[model samples]
Target chain A: MSDREVGGAAEAAAAVIPGSRAMLAVIARSLSPLHGQVTVPQFRILVILADSNVALRSGDLAKALDVHPSTLVRMADRLVARGLIRRSENSASRRETLIELEPAGLDVVRTVTRRRQRDLRRILERMTSGERAAFVDAMQSFTRAAAADADADLTSFGL
Target chain B: MSDREVGGAAEAAAAVIPGSRAMLAVIARSLSPLHGQVTVPQFRILVILADSNVALRSGDLAKALDVHPSTLVRMADRLVARGLIRRSENSASRRETLIELEPAGLDVVRTVTRRRQRDLRRILERMTSGERAAFVDAMQSFTRAAAADADADLTSFGL
Candidate 1:
């Protein structure tokens, strides 16, 4: 496309995307309390552990988060220091270490997630019920498509 | 709400939000070239210039971006160094400096934005036409609400 046409398309797209970039920033700001306690990467780790309900080996956690093993190790060290997560030797594999969320970590995730929910609920309340239903359906479809791409990427990596 | 109830609400909200957090990460990854050349905050500056179609005072740019003056200055310096943006003293006011996108900067913005549009279009293609229309409507509503909140905050700040 010509530069002018590209600019026009971008303006149109920007109008349609609902300022999601800004809303995401606002949501992140609302989670400042949790951020004060743990960085976003660490919080992700906690969330993964809370969601899985099982200890994950270090390599597995790194793979799941798409972070380098060394980066994950550093983040894990910080979380361990803060008592938000624990590192334990894997029973099934003597050479591997398992990462698990602590009670405190779970609490943090719960609190932050609840706050995010309340914030999102307020946003949804601005729309009519029909709009909300439509949004839910549309978003579900988008997420499904994105998840499929993620799965394909994982498969390529032999994950 | 009780903790359990809050947890349930959060889970439901998570299911409904279409993994926006992850989608954002994916989008950011797709813009890796732009990111490698300019940080996100710097890119926002170029976008603002492109959208306004006119030069903006440094203070006004910082205000629009919700960033600290020092931070904006640092980012501007980097952009200027890369020749993507230019900084000039305002002719009307010696104390004020104007920031404008260089041709290079505008080109970069257009390229990245077009790439983003293509990425979003691919995702939308996975949905039926009806779903795409519904999504556009829903996202428009959500963006309007978020913009209103932003305006309210700005007003409260006497900006």
Candidate 2:
């Protein structure tokens, strides 16, 4: 890209930051109820389990989180202590254990999700119908491009 | 709010998450070049100084970052060691020291910001003109509501 073109792009991109931070702030606030009970990484574990209803192999969970297997075990120990997750020997493999989200884990995830939705609703309902329609359209298009870029590999171009 | 109303809002709110994550991912990738060289919190210090232009009092910087004064001192000491920032005693006040972003610090922030903007432009340009217009409008409206919600204090209603 030409320097001028990159400059123009930079201007357009800067527009998104402040607003994005605000939305992220909103999402974070939704997690406040968990406070000291569940740290962000711990909540991430709950989310992964909540997303996949079936129990995850301990090895697989560590890979998904990009953490060392030992690190995953340490984190899981805390969650188990808090009754947020349970571990069971994998029936398919005697050597493997599966991590399953406990009912309490799911409940906390749902609570956080519901709070997020409420904040979204409160903010979204304030916009005009035209704006909302545009929001949906804009988001669809943006997501499509974002996905393609992600697939292209983000490490390119010194990023 | 009625259950139906909240449910509707939730549906609308859900549309933003995937795209928001995509955008946030892009922003994060822009920071990859700083990996091991400068941590996220350290970059944050650079950004605040870049934004302010002038040097900031050490105590003020600590308060702005919501970190303990001693913690800020340690972080600043590291930055001073790296030559990304410098600390100097306040001439006006015998008690205070000032933290200033060095030219190197400004350069890094610019590089990351420019990378982010380029990604933004690339994504935004792929959209139709109508979609772009809508995106801008949607963001403006959304940001306004976000500001109001922040002012309302997110802790209310269990966040």
Candidate 3:
């Protein structure tokens, strides 16, 4: 491809991430209270555990969130300190740790989830049903484009 | 309101923020180098300046971003270091400083805009023209909804 074509492809490939970042700032601002009570990394770990059907390894969690394994380890340590999650060695892979939400973790997730659901519904109520559907569809499309733009690589980040 | 009614209302009101946050994470990841180079707050400052018709005071920027005036001041310090933006004393208000993007800041915003437009076009290319229109409309709706939801008194944060 020509240099201009390459730049076009690169831009096409990376555009949604910043757009989503703009959206996330609003989301983060709305949910800032949670950070006053719980750190973002810790909250993310809780959400992963709460939403999972079974316990997952740190590597798996890291991969899913597209965070470095070291970052996940630090977050897991904080969660354990807060009694929101428990981590134990995986017998099959001693180096790997399996993590699950504890009772407190579940409670935290429940509270956060409830609050989040309320906020989402309120936003939706403001929009016509058609708008809501369109929003969700655009989100899905943006995500799909992003995933492709990332070259579908997640194993290294464990995402 | 009844206890249950209040709980339900709170939940409905809180949901959109997190969902939008998750979507933003995906978007930010997709955009890559733009964020890799600048912190989100710094980028926000740049965006606001880019969108502004005239230089803005720290208070106006703080209010626009739902951040503390001190936070904007600190961010402005960093931006000045990067030479991306500059601050000038407001003649009308001795205590107020007007923030404006420097040439570097303008260039950065311009590149980001071009990249985003290309990205949107590429993503839209995957769908019919009607779908693209719907997608932009959805994003605008989402922005409005989040902005309205955010209008709820954040005065506690001194915002």
Candidate 4:
């Protein structure tokens, strides 16, 4: 394709990404049963926590996910409710609540990752190597641009 | 990185796509300057009509976007109010209001596509060719897996 054609396609593809994201949200919702029952956002929080060596406080999780503190509070509440994480007073700070993933949560993450890998493998098998390469490159470019666009105005929205 | 490591990274990267999609939603929201007061959803309807090359009733748009018919009703009402689309009077189907984008709607799509391509260019410039190639491959795999995973009822919530 010519540069103009490529540009047009990129914009056209960008136009579809939102709907694709919504579809992925549905996919994430469907995966809740593979592990112990958990919401996708809650599991995302667990993955972030499990990946970190140190326990994360609620505020840190909120910052990492670019979500409101109240949203993190609600997520933390749900995770705690599900026994996937424990919330208690921080040893170093009285005002902070340190969040730690329990063994069950760790197991859940493993199971979920395995399931996703299997799904990914099947999906990758369908693509030509070149097509796969192009798709990932597009995603990275799209992501970086979106992030820059977002960071340009952090407080523009309430979030 | 090995395939395993690359896959993990892709999964991590995949987590960011939803946030990017949300940013696009924000961009869609910022279309007021071009729209001269059209709603984002109305613009979306226009784009969908323009892209389809065939008249689509409000119900089809709602279903395609996973929104409610009433939402489509409201959006259709706004588009018709602005004279960017006219509801066809159908003798065969009185209930179905077939929609076609007007010349004004076409102008809006052209402007939106241009702005989006500029954002796309900014993103593509940030990556090395090799990195871009690998990233694109990874994304294609990730999206393919994600779509299949959804179809297979596999949720990534555990990870």
Q: Output the number of the lDDT-best candidate.
A: 2
CA shift of B4, model 3, Å: 19
Residue range B1-159, candidate 2, lDDT tens digits: 567555555667887766655655676667778877898778878887887789999887787666799999899989889999988778899788888988898888888877766767788776655566567667777888777765543322110
**In candidate 1, what are the lDDT values of residues B39-126, reduced to their tens digit?**
6667778877887789899888888777798888989999999999998888889999999999999988788766666666656655
In Å, residue B140's CA in model 3 sits off its true spot by: 4.4
Model 2 lDDT, full chain set: 0.74
lDDT tens digits, residues A18-122, model 3?
A: 334335444454456576667765676676677674689989888877789998888888878887789877889888789988898888767755555555666
Write the residue-wise lDDT of candidate 3 on B1-159 in tens digits: 456555543443443343453344444443464655667668777877776657998898888777888988898898899899998998998988899999998777666656555654555455544555555666677657756666543311110
Per-residue lDDT of model 4, residues B10-81, tens digit only:
554354434334344344333535645665556667767777777887787787655799988887788778
TM-score of chain B of 2: 0.84
Name the runs in model 2 displaced over 4 angstroms: A1-11, A150-159, B1-10, B148-159
Native contact recovery (fnat) for each candidate is 0.31, 0.54, 0.26, 0.14
TM-score of 1: 0.76
In model 4, the runs with Cα more than 4 Å from the true position are: A1-43, A103-112, A127-159, B1-55, B65-91, B98-120, B127-159
Q: Which ranking of candidates, highest TM-score first?
A: 2, 1, 3, 4
Q: Which 10 consecutive positions of candidate 3 chain B have the poorest summed lDDT? A: B150-159
lDDT of 1 at B159: 5
- Encode model 2's per-residue lDDT on A7-83: one tens digit a residue: 54455567776665566567756777887899877887887788778999988878766679999999999999999
Q: List the RMSD of every prediction in angstroms.
A: 6.2, 5.2, 6.6, 8.6
The alpha-carbon deviation from the true structure for residue B145 of candidate 1, after best TM-score superposition, in angstroms, is 2.8
